[model samples]
Target: MRKVWVGILMFWAGLAQAEEVVIAALGDSLTQGFGLTQAEGFVPQLETWIQSRDASVRLINAGVSGDTTAGGLARVAWTLQPEVDGLIVALGGNDLLRGIDPNEVRKNMEGIMRAAQTAQVPVLLIGMQASNNFGTEYKADFDRVFPELAKSYDAAFLPSFFAGLSDGEGPQDPAALRQWFQADGIHPNADGVSLIVEAVGPKLEGLIAKIDAVGE
Candidate 1:
């Protein structure tokens, strides 16, 4: 009876530990928690949100300020340690700011997807739109890169991560964009991070369930 009880305890312990899921929010300053303290950035806040549900999901912020798609690609291998279960790819803003070729962005992002596939991790791509100032041709190309990649990769696609809060016409619908960003008009404030957490929480939850089922 003693031995059986010990084995049962061990099994439950293993099950408890298995509840933990590590999520990598890999991108630029946004991922780095720009304009906010470590606690306020999306990663920490997102973890809190996850905890509110399962209390076991971990969010790893791998944001690099001023990083381009190529930059993200360069570091993909090292960042995607096998223990990680999911990825939030929020890049290419710098590329758009520099007016880099959309083709380059697409290629770089594809590389990212390939690396994640090699690691057997699911990805959640955060798409960004080109600033309207960049001209229609450039805008179209930049916007197209994300959906194209999402479809090809079969990743979770948040059509506009910052959708309703987007720069121009988006925020006009009272209380849409203001709640997500600070006065600076750049980084997401704490409230904004909360909104993000709310938006992505369900999807992350579903992903976790799927992974758990497969592991079982």
Candidate 2:
């Protein structure tokens, strides 16, 4: 009886130790792996990277192609299920591309963040910058939106998630960013998405660590 009880206790302990950390990757085509297949997308690569470090993470890819901030807002409750422990929000690219009002984008993002906070999920806001060709005023408005939203929401901020990528400048001779894009000239290739996962890994780890520490 003693030996059987010990074995049962050990089984429970192992199960507890193997609990998964659920993470949600929510955004646009970039999150959906636009240029490449789903397996090669950012979230899959990120999940692989996370598992390499800690094998218990489950990263959910909630990306929607052609999804705008409004769409993300609409689907937040359903998409961000209760299992979500952390959220990586990579949005607003389509908003800027569509020339949507910066204020509207801000409002939508704020609403999303509010919902995340209410759910007690940690958030990491991925930022994007508009093309200078959009004019200085428009670029400024779009560029400033992310930082402000990050600050207001008290979320981790990644300034210009594709900071090194070029808008045009020729894909072959892509302004030092050729290596990070697929043939599409817009969406990140598998290699490019891998780079992003690598760049953001440390930040994500830090946030996870902090959360774990608080529970201790």
Candidate 3:
């Protein structure tokens, strides 16, 4: 009876550990939790959101401030380590800010996706849009890179990382959006991080489901 009970305990423990998923969040300062407390940053907040949904998951922050898609591509191999079960690719903001060529961004993103594919890890591609200041043609081209790549790679897609922050009635009103950002007006504040987490949480859950389905 004692040996049987020990075996049952070990099995349950293994099952619990199996439920814990390790997700690597690969991106820019936003993923790094810039301008926010460590506990309030994107990774931590995202983890909290995941736990709230009763999912056992962990997020590894591989974000570098001002990193472009090329940068992300360069680090894909190392970031997607042996224990990494999935990836969250949230790059391209710096590429947009620097007005880098959309085709180049697309290629770089494709490379990153391919790297993830080779590792047999699922990906969640988070997209960003170019501001109007970059002009209509640039905006259109930049906007298409994400969804196109996501479709081609069969990755999960989050159209805009900052989707729920505005109601569309006053997008241009900095005052209305001010509360969502820090003084730099670029990286989100803690409140903004919460909103972003809420918006992306469901999609993340879907990605987790994919990972579980694949037995990763």
What TM-score fits each model?
0.85, 0.86, 0.92
Question: What TM-score quantifies how close candidate 3 is to the native fold?
Answer: 0.92
lDDT of 1: 0.79
Report the lDDT of model 2 for residue 64: 97
User: What TM-score should be assigned to candidate 1?
Assistant: 0.85
RMSD of 2: 3.5
TM-score for candidate 2, please give it. Answer: 0.86
Q: For residues 12-85, could you state the per-residue lDDT of candidate 1 as single tens digits? A: 99997777788788899877888898898878877887898745878888999999999999998888987788
Question: What is the alpha-carbon lDDT for the whole of candidate 2?
Answer: 0.80
Cα deviation in Å at residue 146, candidate 3? Answer: 0.3
Q: Candidate 3 residues 6-125, lDDT tens each?
A: 999999999988778999999999999987889999999999999988888989999999899999999999999988999999998889888999999999999999999999999999
- Residue 32's lDDT within candidate 2 is 85
Residue lDDT tens for model 2, 1-216: 999999999999988765767788889998888868868988898888878995577888899999999999997887778677788898988998899988898889888999998887878888877776678898899888888988887788787667434342112245567667766667888877777787777767865764565346
Model 2 lowest lDDT segment of ten: 163-172
lDDT of 3 at 89: 95
What residue runs in model 2 are displaced by over 4 Å at the alpha carbon?
Answer: 1-10, 164-173, 213-216
Better of 2 and 3 by lDDT: 3
Candidate 1 stretches with Cα past 4 Å from truth are 1-11, 164-180, 213-216
